[model samples]
Target: MRRNTTFLSAAALAVTLALPVQAQDAPDAATVLARVGEAEITLGHALALREQLPEQFLSVPDTTLFPAIVEQLIEQELLHQHKADDLTRRQRSMLDNEVRNFTANAALSEVAIAAASDEAIAAAYEAFAAEFGQGEPETEYNAAHILVQSEAEIEEVAAELDGGRPFDEVARERSIDGSAQSGGDLGWFGEGVMIPAFEAAVMELEPGEVSPPIETQFGWHIVRLIDRRDAQVPPLEEVREDLSGEIQREAARAFVEELRAAAEVENLATDMDPSILGQRELLDD
Candidate 1:
């Protein structure tokens, strides 16, 4: 069956976001998905690669995308197979440093993630739910607004609205925000994501109702509630990647803390003026 590009895109993002570091030795390509020659390419690896590809490349049809990536991988493997050994001292040193950094980062990430436990993740989820006021999920607005720095501009826009002029037209004419490009499409967002003042203004308006004007740090906004819906708790399957990262980060911190408690660490000076370094004259000798 052909892979679902959109679903794969989301999955690819999840994998990348969940695990930012790449392991030196990954699952063999043939065993995981399909392979090209001696080089193994797994589905996970493909997905990871697809995530990192440029946006324009991502838009290319998968039929073309797949073969192209295979060819690219084969070329890389071919180069690896016949890499020249001759190198200047500086070149070798640079190579050594690059390899060392890559290995260290990958190994540390693995250790951090592995240290996480099921209980810890569960606790974190519960805490997050509680913080969001885990009451019955309410309707969330996916609205947009044209922001202006002055009340006069806000009133002028309001007048245009009163005169039956399309809000989008006025938005394009006067909005100072980046949203002006798309006629102020802020896209889907839930409560707590926006500033309190903005949220309050949005909450007061009924769906399809446009507000007169509201002020916030960004400036005055004339918001239109484009759409609203009863927000649902995303299934664990939907948000597993984010949860995994959170668990990994917490585990890493806890592990580091435990080690710190068991180790002997001391600061050489209780207090030292950094300016003292400016007076150093021994190096002149």
Candidate 2:
């Protein structure tokens, strides 16, 4: 099916193929190639459309592509001009959204392309590494806990802990939770298990230190940070894509802020009935 389409594209491009416009012999872009009613499609239009062609169409010979592009532009113009001037309110709204989306994306692309220079990425990596403990592998902890149904039970466990009972021993005897059997060992998890109240409490404790009683939905927890080990952080090259996106986002945010600071803006709809947004018939007119 695609082969036939390719053949057709090549044929369309070749229609003007009486002579292939080699790089040296290229005609002026302003030269008109065809007419539809009163509108002229020029060589410039064909060349520009060819630049935007999808990869599959590009593989076709320039001879084939030239005619195909011309055909495509002519057909598109005909369809566009055939449509009445009276676009529906909904259509105009959608077209406005598309235009905004394209322009905003193009602006962001420009920022992203310019921001990811080698020096910029290197700088970003340095900052990132510093924030990430200066390239020290992040630490993952092995922990054990005694979970009990009440504050009273937790205090008992704390007393036993303070009295020098081993955490795993205490866990074996006092923890009603499953890990109690394993001395509450949650083996290893990385950062984007990112954060949580339970994890926060865990992080604050030095290995072998017992936490003050922590209350959670499960019950009271007497947690011990048993041991911790370093977890790998990817090298800069490995995470270049992620860092590039971050750079792009940061640049985009700064650009938007500059625009906001320079522009005069007003919002007059604050008191209006937001429910009116649901009225579909409003667009019918």
Candidate 3:
């Protein structure tokens, strides 16, 4: 579903807002641009509306955005003046929810922005480095396989290996798998990359050792172990983006928990039939 749907269509405004824009000194948002009857539409209204737009629409040039946004505000004002007092209960409830959601998000955005400051990021990175460095070096496996339709086909493939035919050579000649073109070589992978049955088979084999026919949902299989190595811990700069995300989440959660502790929130629907939530007619004014 579309996110944060607005009164004006994003696609419609995109075309209208695409007119050429030249650079110029910016004006104050409070500057009045239009009067819808007695109601004034200011640059602030246009700017706020533009800010409310989805990210995909934000790249539209501002000079082009000004007239179109003012026009939209005038239209909105005309509509509201015509019948805003006549809004049905559903429309009013939806508008209330939209305002609540937008304002709450604005508040949480402040917390997240503060949480991801340079000092916070540095502290988070230090903790991550300590915890990450404490773990045993991770192991990786390089393996290959021949996938076949049934037990008989896999056995025939395995028997060819017993006769000293190269695994890759037999794979190309008889294997139905896609990797047959590359000598059935599934290249380097870390632990947990393969399905459980396949991974279990690989771990039991050393380099150059091929397995007996193993069954999985796709069909039967035999895996050959190729090589193994340990993965190194990545440097801080490489993982900074992820670290900052974790910092933001932790701070938001802590702030929310603190608020919850001091609040008197309670659910009043404890005894209501949950299925009543689907009765759309109940929303009628």
Candidate 4:
């Protein structure tokens, strides 16, 4: 059996094939490419379809892609013209949803563009650095502690350490906290991380000196300061992308809030079953 194939007009295919080599200097998008019935397919339509092609298709040569894409657009135009007056309820509903989604995206793009301008991004970066950057090198502490359920347990652990038993050995045998297995090593941390009382005790201890039992909500603690160092802030370039994203999100949120405040909205479904959201069949008709 000989299978039949629908192909584009020979002249149209020749013109499309030549487009790849001259793509950089192609005519204006308004130039007409083909016509299906009364509907016209323009260069813009072909370019838009090309943009939406899957990533796998991107590596295809432009010469090969140009005619194929144009043919696809012509086929789609023909189908659209044939079905224009016979759309099903589902198709109409989907078109309405797409219109809403694209409109919302267009508005968000405007907000993002204004928010990400060079001047706006620079100002945001300045503000973020002033608020969060360390103006001077800040101190970090390396410390360890033995946590116990009762004051008596902490006292016993402290006494063993004073009597020349190793701090890690004492912690492994007596501490109840999660770090006990790792010799109660808290790793390096800055101030404001531990509870107020615990931090205060840690700050007061000299390296190699153990504290008397300190009380916190978690339990009693014997802390040993191991070392300390000053940490510097990262360069602005290292964090610019994060700052720009934060500014864009804040701007979009503010824009949406302004629109919401000026609009009249009502919750007509206040009494409706919330579980109705799980019923995809509701969109059927």
Q: Which candidate is the best by TM-score?
A: 3
Please provide TM-scores, in order, for all candidate models, with all chains considered together.
0.49, 0.56, 0.69, 0.59
lDDT of 2 by residue, 161-234 (tens): 88988888888888888887787786776655723767888899898788999888889997778778886555
Candidate 4 Cα RMSD after full superposition onto the native fold (Å) = 10.4
* lDDT accuracy of residue 221 in candidate 2: 91
- Estimate candidate 2's alpha-carbon lDDT, on a 0 to 1 scale: 0.77
Q: What do the candidate models score in CA lDDT, each in turn?
A: 0.70, 0.77, 0.79, 0.79
Q: Give per-residue CA lDDT, model 4, range 1-285, as digits (tens).
A: 111123344454445453222344567788777777888778887787777666776786788778877777777778778887888777787777777887887898889778887787778778876776556667788899999999888778877988999999888888898999999899888888989998999889888888889999999999999988875444667777887788888988999999999999787999998998898776675
TM-score for candidate 3, residues paired by index: 0.69
Candidate 2's TM-score: 0.56
Q: Model 1, stretches more than 4 Å misplaced? A: 1-107, 113-139, 235-241, 261-285
In order of lDDT, best first, we have 3, 4, 2, 1
Worst 10 residues of 4 by lDDT: 1-10
Task: Give the residue spans of candidate 4 off by over 4 A.
Answer: 1-26, 133-229
How far is 224's C-alpha from truth in model 4 (Å)? 18
What ranges in model 2 sit over 4 Å off? 1-24, 27-32, 42-44, 47-63, 134-137, 140-229
Query: Over the full model, what C-alpha lDDT does candidate 4 score relative to the true structure?
Result: 0.79
Ranking by TM-score: 3, 4, 2, 1
